[model samples]
Target: MSQTSNSSSRLSALLLAAMACAVSPAVVSAQSADSATAPGLPATPTPNATINLIRLMVERGLLPAADAAKLVEQAETEATQARAAITAAAQPAPVAPPPLEPDTVRVTYIPANVKRQMIEEIRSDVMAEAVAENWAAPRTFPEWVAKYKFFGDVRFRYEGDFYPDGGVPGGTIDFNRINTAAPVDYFSSTSTAQPPSYNADQTRERFRFRARLGSEIDLADNFTSGLRIATGESSSPVSQNQSFGASGGNFSKYALWLDRVFLKYEIQPKAGSSFSAIIGRTENPFFATSMIWSNDLGFDGLVLQGKRKVGENLTPFFTLGALPVFNTSLNFGTDSTASSGGGKAYASQDKWLYAAQTGVIWNINNDLTLKAAIALYEFQNVEGEVSAPIDATTLNTTSGFIGSTDSSRPGFAQKGNTYIALRELTNSTLPGAGNFQYFGLATPFRELAATARLDYNHFEPFQVSLIGEVVTNLAFNSGDIASNGPTQLPGPRNNNSFSGDYEGGNVGWNVNLQVGAVALQKAWDWTAGLGYRYVESDAVVDGFADSDFGGGGTNLQGYTVSGNLALSQNVWMGVRWMSANSIAGDTFKADVLQIDLNAKF
Candidate 1:
């Protein structure tokens, strides 16, 4: 290992030397001048403070002193001659003028055809080399091991709570005063006001591993297939405890799942337009994703997509498809033994989902970027019934809506009065030989959504971004929308009265300051930010309490402060604190501390 390491270091230095020589413009400029002064003399490098680097390296035994001195002497000689020639050429000169009664003007314009020919030649050479290197040609195998690329990240974390909550309260104050000011007593034992489930003990530890493998292969002149296998964890909307349900974490386990698998055949069936029909599972191509670069909102189905780039900065993208939607809530649940009758119940449906999204990217300026997209996504339940039985008097299924034909229906009616679902009786698994199923007429029930994202990064030392999204279900426009369908599955005692409509929106703002690293180049590179988010869910079910409305409450507003500190070029640590208050004065607070080390192999 040591021998290999030493050899690698030597190779790195060789490459650095080559790069330094290539861009040594100062030395080159002096050599060019010296060439004019003494035509037959060999050009030399210019003397500069940077050249001292070579001398220092030689002294430290990092470089050959003999070679370094020879190069330095040649450089100085060239610089001196160049300086002399330039000085001699600067001597005073006299100018004479002539007058003429008429003159004929002539001009020559070189055709860009010459430039095009030169570029084409260079391009052909590059292509030849790429083909020889097996870099440009598609792999021979469609599977097994085509051309694959892999990437991922790892993180380490450390957390310290000095005050155990708010860092000791900032001044001389009584313990009673501090307790009253923050109201931690009513919310939690820790001053942070976080749920006991999220504490992770005094100092928490968390690790994440994300990796993706992608490859593409050609089947014909215009047909190709591609696939991606990725493993990663994503945050969920539902509470962690409820979301994971014993998968072992509020955070789901990482598993190898297909992010995309599609086959495409180009259609030249035009002059200025073209199209491609893609079949299989792939990104829905709708919605704006910030945390995940690839399509976070992917669906399984067929898509007919088309693209046209009128100019360098303007392009239009369109896609339409009938996709399959997996119930994220149910998909992440842990019911491993439920099939054996020992875990939480599950609900699922059997129905085809669909979605469509069309958007355009308009580059108005170099520094400013803008995009607009409109999308429609529908979630359909496939299974018409839930077979999982919880116990006697209870049917364990995946969810309440999963076992029935009208799984997507919001609520039921009881005694001429509508009430939201009391519970899903089908989540429990029954003593059965087959999985439960549901069926329903395919409906184009759509969620109309729009988003606007502006990235203003050209302003220089600081980068700013503003993003916003708004979505609403057009079918359920009214405040008291109700589902006029069967209330429950076949059961001994049928008691169903559930009806409610929930509509909500969120707005948030963030500001950041990038601190300079020039002052403390190694120990302190950082960015500090402050953010605020306001969310409100209106017209909740009449029975559910406000505190249980959304993730936090019916109406939520939070203030957060965070920063990242760099301990090295490849490693950094981050911390964030958030304090949120419900409309009813309830508080939900969180603190996160994390460290990350990143390097490429």
Candidate 2:
């Protein structure tokens, strides 16, 4: 019984030891292989350590092999159950949901009344500020005044005229003897005579200025009115510059004259198409250069212009115009002569000009543009005529001479037209009458002109342009021009006759190349150009050609070099040089240099 008891205690002790080993950290770590795959089962135990312990126990005769195996199995089973219980305890518990309410949807928003109140508050503030700033003040003005715009420009210039010594051949003339029997001696005069010639080679300098003011107003729907006042002589069509020394020793105030006043009406029937009519001393209605017409010249008459777009990049245009170039009305009736006596006579006539043009503008690409035009211009009733007043004078040798009586001549002679002097018919009582001359327009003028321009603006802030123009006179009648006879006045054998064949057939051409910084606002902005022009005598109305070239007349060929540099946003300085020579009857040369400062507003 004592031995049995001892054996039982030993087995109990061994079982307790086995159970402690199974709960060891090593055993727990080994059993972590896969608790997920098997719910109450441990991973297969590692046999190395467990097997050694069991064998030692058996060998020491503490227990039989089968008993050791049974103890090991019991330990593993307990450990697996322990691990499963731990895993189960670590898992989350099932949660119970709260009680349900009735079905409904909820929305949160400001009330409409509150939103309206906020908007009204903002409006009231704005209105109060506007009232404080006088936004509700009543305004009174003429309806026409509200549609008007005013603009103008001013220019100051320093000019120089330089002539070489041994003056150009055929450059001298005696105005007093222009109508004498002599041949006028214009072609054979020498510059180095004992007394210098009238047009002796010399240098002259002067300061000049020009100013203009203009206004445009909308008169009615599609109708507009424009007017301009400028500083210059009323009869001068090509220049507005006034010389500083004309005051005769005092500070002289310059004269101002009407430059332009016109009315325009436009109609647009559809997109990309329009037509316009202008009347009353209007702007030049053609695409022309100074080669054909001066920039300052205005036309007095009516013009019709129209344009239409054919495609995205092409436009065609047309212009037709008529202008009254001159009007002369004069009466000669002396106090000593009866109302129906032979002394009463009259001279009256009118000159008219008509023009037509067709052109196209092509925008070749984003950077290039081209324009071309063809034009025809005609002059009518330009020839001088002999007329009789209501109470006419009988024909007499001394009475019928040009300038002999007030009825024989026009009141004013346009500056640049070729003229013939009537020396025998002069009146000593009249001042500046010793050299009276008559415009020799014995035939009409018919002209055809072609023009083209190209512009390239691909380079930023810089542009280049090439321009060309050609004009030809087609109504040349030498016979009719030469048929013009001397004055019928009886004098010392009127020796002066129309010396040469006065034909109207002539050609004029001009070409220019220019490069510049297109916008002249920034510092250092500049432009420059070189040009050549050749205009034959009678090719165009000399009074309307470039007034600064060759002393403002035709029969000239020249080269011009010009440049401008910006001084400020709306001001610039310009320099130009022109070297020109006459192309007809006499050899004449002139050089003009100009420096100008200009401002615009």
* Model 1 Cα lDDT, one tens digit per residue, 403-476: 22223322210010111221233322334312222212111234566666666667544455555655444443
- Model 1, position 475, has a per-residue lDDT of 40
Task: For residues 1-601, write the lDDT of model 2, one tens digit per residue.
Answer: 2443444456557654855555445544443332323332223435434434544444434444556667656555554665676778789999896655677545569899999999999999987887777564456345656899899999999999876554453343322223222212121122123211234367889898899999999887899999999997345777888888764638867789899999999998878889999999987889988988888888999999999999899989999998988665445333224233545443345677899999999999999999999999897765443222212121121233333222223222222233332223323223322222332333356889999999999986899999999998787555544544344322111112235433233689999999999778866799999999998766776657888876665677889999999988889999999998766544557789999999988
Best by lDDT: 2
Pairs that clash in candidate 2: 181-495, 342-393
- Provide the overall lDDT of each model, using Cα atoms, as 2-decimal numbers: 0.42, 0.65
Off by over 4 Å in 2: 1-145, 166-200, 330-347, 385-437, 487-505, 519-521
**TM-score, structure 2 vs. true:** 0.66
The residue-level lDDT of candidate 1 at 438 comes to 25
In model 1, which regions exceed 4 Å deviation?
Answer: 1-205, 218-222, 232-259, 265-276, 290-297, 311-313, 326-349, 381-445, 460-463, 477-595, 598-601
lDDT of 2: 0.65
